[model samples]
Target: MRIGQPGRPLDARKDELILQAGRELLLRGGPLALTMEAVARASGVSKATLYRRWPHREALLEALVLREAQPLLSMLEGTPTDDAGLAAKLEAFLDSMLALMGQPGYRAYLQAIVALPQQQADLQRIWWLGPHQTMESVAALLRRYAAAQGRRWPAAARDAETLIGMAIGLEQARILYRQRPWRADARLRRRLIRAVVASFLGRRSAGIAVCEGNVGRG
Candidate 1:
């Protein structure tokens, strides 16, 4: 990890070690304890290595959020071959995200990031403007599905943003009240997607329509 070390070999486990160490530190003592030195000691990686990977504490923490969110992003990728498939993927993505936010690790990470102190202007800027990959991914998934159905959801992005916002807000409230973690209501949320589409298109059955449910009951 020395600077100017010619032909230095990279450790394959470096990123994993650093990120895992960062998570442990954050989980153990929140943001205050997640210093570069702490992560280096915990992971047995050099501070230099940590900086090389992420220029500052904010960058490292942001990477951690993105890493944790990978599964939600994965769930929504690619075109679903049919209406039912599309509806299922979208629902699963929504379900997984809400469920994830209720988990201890991911919830704590979000809590730390979302409520970062006012002094952390840089990190706040990065987060507020967003990588928002999951939200963006959901929007993209909706558009593709609409295309497949030979229709347009004019408000897909706006609705997708609202849906994501609500899921996070619900989990934030749960976190605030110290409620036991919970999962998304799979059938109900899928039905919600159908309802959203129908509202915009003005039919009980329209785009990705039943959301492919009859817009159906479970």
Candidate 2:
């Protein structure tokens, strides 16, 4: 008989154990240490069961990130009725992302992935795919915010990417590269969020002005 029977209900407890084991292994020893054997041993689950849930290591890692991203994703899924509401939600999302990046284990994992040899397609693939959906959701939020003001921001999706990239870059520069004490005080977080929002709005206004000038010339 199959280890997990066809009709048998899956155990939530076992799934949590497996995920928890995977997370601990990842945080403790990077991706290289998170082999199927290690996870199975750590979680005290049979290899067959682990394989039954996650076919490969990448799949398991992706699941872990997705789980971690749920709260931020939930906020993105919300509807913000006004400029203030959108700005508040965006700030919350950025704060959440910064918090995730601030985690030593998570930061190490991202840095390790980035430092991998160019020949490793997995690194590039993960980097692109890991945050693609969340960025899209963010773009949707930005678009909604602009629409509410009766102004269309061209390249909302690109702007979303830029906002996230800026946050990550700031964290890397201050906390990771400089090895400075990471102080995510409320004031700093607010400043970062404001910078991103202001930059986007500035570019958006400039674009509108340029278009208007061209229309006048025509």
Candidate 3:
């Protein structure tokens, strides 16, 4: 039995403290800054206690990210049985992603995952569950909406992927390029989100760039 095993439940207070420290450190200096030793000092928890919770910095970072990611995943739950309802779900999906991408730390987290050693596959796989699961939900929602409209969308899965990619490109433009990030303004974001929702529902919006059929599919 380990220190925080089933026989010995872990302390919630300590977990919160550690994760808070981890978030602060990661955001302040990116993934390279979030060392267990640094977390121990910032969190006021001993190194031994920290290690007992997470074996390494990667594990600690994973815990910190997943905690925040849960809310995003939860936004897709429940039945959206109508066009309005489905649009709401898709809007929620985009909104949740916007919230996540708004965090500078998230981009840092993405960099860290990309830099992981090829042998360290587990970290990348675990961290990706958020986006992957959300994609699954988006695909499911698209399928349901299409079926209700008496049509077959064989490309629902592909379209869902495209939507997610576009959202990422929208937010990550500042990082990938020197252009403006999502926080540029509220109006721009709303316009982009509305365009995305409109496109996915097959109703074109005014003058907004819509993702055409397999145009950027790679």
Candidate 1, which ten residues in sequence have the lowest lDDT sum?
196-205
Q: Please list the residue runs of candidate 1 whose C-alpha ends up more than 4 Å from where it truly belongs after superposition.
A: 1-10, 122-131, 165-169, 184-218
Instruction: By TM-score, rank the candidates, best first.
Output: 2, 3, 1
Candidate 1 overall lDDT versus native: 0.67
Each candidate's lDDT (Cα)?
0.67, 0.74, 0.70
User: lDDT tens string, model 3, 162-193?
Assistant: 87776566567676554557544557766777
Model 1: clashing residue pairs? 208-211, 209-212, 210-213, 210-214, 210-215, 213-216
TM-score of model 2 vs. true structure: 0.77
Ranking by lDDT: 2, 3, 1
Q: Better model by lDDT, 2 or 3? A: 2
Better by TM-score, candidate 3 or 2: 2
Cα lDDT tens digits for candidate 2, 1-218: 23355665566667878899988887666666678899999989999989988999788877776776678888887667775677678778888877776665766776666565667755544555457778988999887776777766667889899878876665677655646525356577678777776675567668767865776465
Model 2, runs deviating above 4 Å: 1-10, 148-151, 165-169, 181-183, 191-218
Better of 1 and 3 by lDDT: 3
Over 103-146, each residue of candidate 1 has an lDDT whose tens digit, in order, gives 66765666666677778764654454344666777788877877
Residue 117 local lDDT, model 1: 75
Distance from true location, Cα of 214 in model 2, Å: 5.4
